[model samples]
Target: AGGQYRLFHRADLIDLLHWAARRAGVRVLLLQKVREVVPGPEPLVRLASGAELCADLVVGADGLHSVLRQALNGDEEPFFTGQVAWRAVIDNPTERRDDVTLHMAPHRHLVTYPLRQGRQLNIVAVQERAAWVGEDWRQQDDPEALRAAFADFAPDVRALLDRIETVHLWGLFRHRIAPVWHREGVALLGDALHPTLPFLAQGANMALEDGWVLAEALGRAEAIEPGLAEYRARREARVARVVRAASGNARKYHLAFPPLRWAARTGLRMAGRVAPGMMLRSFDWLYGVDVTEGSAARSRK
Candidate 1:
């Protein structure tokens, strides 16, 4: 089990969190859409229904189009990264849940992995295009369009695509990591702080880390300002590094030049065969981190 990567289905994970949070006596509210957030000594959250809530501190875990992030930083648009992706889940007859696989070609790539105890396979197909697509991932796209994008892919990949009857499409867009993470009673969390490309598969993980580090920082601080500042200091460098690394991944998969692509693949294959441990160890600083220990130590005098 050492040096292994684990994957979880998003919906299933959310359900688990709901159960855990409620078990811990945390009230879980749904369907109350937020209208705006006002940050100061005491933060205020105004819901669209005109219901208002006050908190000693407001944390924006609202994700990419976060209303709170906009509240703090004002309006700024995230530029399209010239890429779009479609996500779908299909029945996995083969029970291929053990590992993720990637199929790459010029300007496009298909990433597939098993989910839900290998009863289903999750597919994410991405391609480079100049056209602007909406940032919404819930926007449905024709299944045929999905097939056409990877028509020339390996037959196994094509067959998996054939099983996708429903797919949602979204444009990949990046916003600069918010210039500020916390202001008085408010702090940004997760994608609200930084929107990362899917390449590193660390977007959700980063958010989880944010929660751990932020909470630990606050627990050890004398005041909210110092705690929030420490949380940002601990997180910003690691997050920026992650975002930069992920941004470079599209180039690796979408290599347009045949020779360049071959060389890259060849080098990877060689690394896999010769020094696989070293290659994986390169990510040790990332995957090996124990935020509990790090945050506790850093929070100490």
Candidate 2:
């Protein structure tokens, strides 16, 4: 939610869903998981409850460990990214605060964003560590472990973590790019197609863009083949660039060298003071992009 609009919690998804449904002619089904997808002359989907669904086209948005993706492209292993993220939302401090604070230290970063209209704060601390097994997001971590990881951080950071009552920690996993994004009538979306690191925070936004392009391509094409091909061709390069940039950023932000880190911070501080719009303008290719317009419009002779 670092965009122009404010951030929101999971509960706000309801309002978003209602708004989306009203604007777009779509249907949403909850608590239903697609167990398997078979792409063929007629695409077939097997539901968790042994139910079957056949559609002219299938798009997989089930996330990192997408079952539909595994069925469509054969199950592939997910690579551990050697990073763990600890998260929790504590009682908002009585001291009035409106702006979000981002504290970056070598090898670790903490970001706090206002939630529930400033009533609560969403805090996420990410650190690079030795490879950890398991990728369950709901797994809880010991508060001591969280504290120990950031023990060297600033006093304010320590104070905030000290007050946390509940927390969850999960290992991040990176995945290799999909060789074949589409097969027959099956197509992949979001993490299913390209799992990116959290450094860039563009994963969700890219998924949203993919959804729009996928639907438009299908709507315009006479057959599923052309639509799926167009969707993959249009998105692969952009999403690949995003993935590489995010991975590079992870390494760049985790510098432990004293002089280098200092110089980096100083440079950003200077940049913030001078030519701030230039920094924002560098991302025009990203934020100013409108996938609905297609790639041809931006192509040069």
Measured by TM-score, the strongest candidate is: 1
Clash pairs for candidate 2: none
Top lDDT hit? 1
The clash tally of candidate 2 reads 0
The Cα local distance difference test for each model comes to 0.90, 0.80
List the pairs of residues colliding in candidate 1: none
Q: Looking at model 2, which ten-residue stretch has the lowest summed lDDT? A: 292-301
Which residue runs does candidate 1 get wrong by more than 4 Å?
Answer: 294-301
What is candidate 1's lDDT per residue for 1-301, written digit by digit as tens?
2676677899998998799889989987899999999998988999999999999999999999999999888899788999999999988967576689999999999999888888888999999999999989679999999999899998888988988899999999988999978898999999999989999899999998899989888988999999999999999999999999899997899999999999989978888899877678778877777777765676595
- Lowest-lDDT window of 10 residues in candidate 1? 290-299
Q: lDDT tens digits, residues 55-120, model 2?
A: 887888878888766776677877777888888887776453566677778788887776776778
Q: Return the TM-score for candidate 1, rounded to 2 decimals.
A: 0.96
